[model samples]
Target chain A: MNILVCISHVPDTTAKINFTADGSALDPAGVQFVINPYDEFGLTKALHIKEAQGATITVLNVGGPETEPTLRKALAIGADQAVRINATPTDAITVAKSIKNHIQANAYDLIICGQESIDYNGQQVPAMLAALLDVPMVNACVGLTIDGSTATAKAEIDGGHATYTANLPMVIGGKKGLVEEKDLRIPNMRGIMTARTKPLSVEEGLSGSNTAAKAFRKPAAKSAVKMVAPDQVNELVRLLHEESKSI
Target chain B: MILVFVESWNNQFKKASFEAVSYARKWADMAGCSVKAVVSSGASNPESLAQYGADSIATLDLAATGPGMAGQLSTMMDGVQGVVVAGTAVGKTLAPTLAALIDGALSTNTTSTPSSVGPVVVERGAFSSKGIETIALSEGMPIVSFVPNAIGIEEKAGAGAIESGSASGTDKVAVSEVSVASGKVALPEAEVVVSAGRGLKGPENWGMIEELAEVLGAATACSKPVSDIGWRPHSEHVGQTGIQVNPNLYIAIGISGAIQHLAGVSASKTIVAINTDPEAPFFKAADYGIVGDAFDVVPRLIEELRAFKAAN
Candidate 1:
């Protein structure tokens, strides 16, 4: 089996979000970048698949040269190879098309990526990529098992979850439940040394975004808490009903 | 006309369906267009859409998978300039695929109505609610997913005429089974949410939390550690890595509030925190806070709420 994992470079969840002076783009200054936490689960699941069954895993990212570090981390964790599409992703549509272009040029049996990047949280690329390729795509996937040429996957819905079956050459958008947090791999010294020798390829990517961000505005700052004594349960209820009108 | 994709399960229209139809109506009025509500199949309360703004109802056997539905919707465009879908799990999966299939512009999880019609312009939450972004779409057909509970439900009284259409069933990614809890309130549409964390000690103490939720008509959620340790199901977990919830009021009990957890819920209109430690980080972001043990405070709060409900 050949699996391709799509990695996204995003700000750490704890980092403060700030935009440029023009309010048109994100300000990367002083922001720490990391592999989007969601994609880590998918990559770990791919490594497990490769370990159990004979398979080769290729980690892919669509960004400028800055994203190579994240792709190398995926390699250090246990991917066999890496590919970098040399383009800054402008929108979900542009990124999906770029990935589709790469997938057409190279064949892979299974594709994996996070449901959404933490920074944008659009949750668009995987489904859009599947549409562009005219293939099956499953998002919010928590459980997945492969049998021969078929893949059985479990995805979360509104009230519960649903199970689905799809053939190979499909895409999966995995999240935390795909693998236990404890099972995620860390780069050991030997693994990091080996990853430095692994193959890393770069290719020009397609451009043009359907939607363009015009401005960025910050949410209003939260006010200090209005504390009520622990014993004042009635007063709290009264405030919730009379003052806030929330109840 | 604006096409609104309304999703349904177990022969009932989901709460998100009403919100989408209502938003489509408002957008249609602003854009000077008519509204059509499209259902995949098996919606028992299709007429309720008329209470919102759907002028007509078009029922089709929409293929269950995103790719399949995108293919079906491509053929049904029929001079429609755009479509509006709820930002539910199903709608988010389908909107982008449909946009890609038809070579249209796409926007998901939009918080506001588009400021312009053709070459639509709108604002959406970005950076996990830390920032609001304005996006402009110049593509011919614009597809958008309106976030659940972001817009208020309105009544416009549509004609609600029903039209039937055939299905182009795509066999890819066939749904083998679906399991949904019967009466639980879904996190997305909940107006109020009651959440607990490891500070509650164990799952055995969840009865009080559930009681509080029941009295408030709220959904029950948990922090990451509570779910990780098997004290609560993963579905209830809300954090940067878990589900993001934007309820009108959020009540956090026994949670110390890590940055990741705050990212998922900071969008809430009001937040109340109950924790044993005064120095818990959640208090910094909450509108109201109480420094006390959950076991001591929750039962009393539940009793107060019940009495308050009786008098009202």
Candidate 2:
């Protein structure tokens, strides 16, 4: 089977969020970028599948040259090839369409992506890609197993979880439940050495609807904390009811 | 007309559905349009949406599950100026599919009704919920999914006339239900969350936490360390890297408030922190703080909450 894993390069989750001088974009100064945790989970799952079933895994991203290092990291983690759709990804719709263009040129038996990127959290690209491909998709997929042309997937729902059975040429949007954090692989010395010679290709892409960020601002600042004594349960409840009106 | 996609799970209309409908109804009032609710099949109590601003309701035929469901929703786009969806698993799937089908701009985690509708301006969570990004869509239909619990449920009477929508044929895939509820509230949909950290000692000590959560009608959540060490399932983990929740009230007990954890829970409306360490960083970010031991404080909290509920 052939698998394509989509990854996003986002700011490290621990990085302090700040905006540019004009508030049009994120201030990259003093920020560290890493693979979106969700996407990393998906990539790690694909590696598990590849190791077991002998599938060729390819890592794909729709970003500029700056994202190549992220792609390289995926390659080091065991992907056979990496493809970069050379464009500044504007929104999920456009990014999905662009990835669809790449998929149209080359087919894959299975596609895996994070439920949503940590930065934008749109949760659209994977669904959009499946829609554009007109294939069945399982979002928030936790457990997945492939048997020949069939795939069994389990996903999270509002109250509980649901299981889905779809054939090949389907999409799976993976999340934290798909794999534990400890399962995430770090690049070994040999893997990193081999990554330098691995295939990393870029292609021009199509664009769809553009949903640009008009402005950015921090969430409302919090007021000073009202510290209560340990025995102030009654007062705390009163404050929650009267002051915050949140009870 | 504004189309509000009402999602259901486990044979009931999710609370998020009504929240989204109410969200769209307010937007419709501002935009000078009517609200048309299209609900999925098997969602019980479809008419109750009338209480939450659904002027008319349309249900997808029972057989419309996969691509057929998408096509059925597409057929409802005749006069839809914009689309509203809840920020649930189902909405995340339908939002982008609808955007692709309509060739429209889509925004998820939208915080409010349109401030003004001409350009369709709205705010969405950004940077792992640390910031808000205002997005404006000029052309085509604006497809937006509301952040769960961000815009609290509001009610305004509506007609709620039910109608049947078209259903395309089935597909090759077969989807089935796996497990039902664990008798606990879902984390994202919870208005109040009782979250803990490793400071609680172990998974065996969760009885008090569960008792407090039960009394408060809140979901239970954990910090990354708790889930990492297997004290809690990954689904219960809340942090920058895990589920980011924006509930109305979030109570963090035995948590020291890592930067990553704060980034996720900071979007909550009100926060209360309880920890033995007075210097724990969570206190700075919390609206209220208590320096106490969980074993002592949690039971007291549960008792206080139960009594408070009885009184109120």
Q: What is the TM-score of chain B alone in each candidate?
A: 0.95, 0.94
Each predicted complex: what DockQ?
0.83, 0.74
Error of 2 at A52 (Å): 0.9
Q: Number of the top candidate by lDDT?
A: 1
Q: Compared with the true structure, what per-residue lDDT tens digits does model 2 show for residues B1-312? A: 899878776577778888999998998999888899987667788899999988899887643343445556776788888888888766777777778877788888888778778889899988888889999876678888888888978989988999877656454358766675778899988999999998899999998888888888899999999999999887788988778898889999999999889988998899999999999999999999999998888888888888999999
Clashes of each: 0, 0
Model 1 spans with C-alpha error above 4 angstroms = none
TM-score of 1: 0.98
Local lDDT at A210 for model 2: 58
lDDT (Cα atoms) of all candidates against the true structure:
0.89, 0.86
In terms of TM-score, how similar is model 2 to the real structure?
Answer: 0.96
Task: For candidate 1, write residues B195-265 as lDDT tens digits.
Answer: 99998999999999999999999999999999998999989999888988888889999999998999889
DockQ for candidate 2, please give it.
0.74
Compute the lDDT for candidate 1.
0.89
| Winning model by DockQ | 1
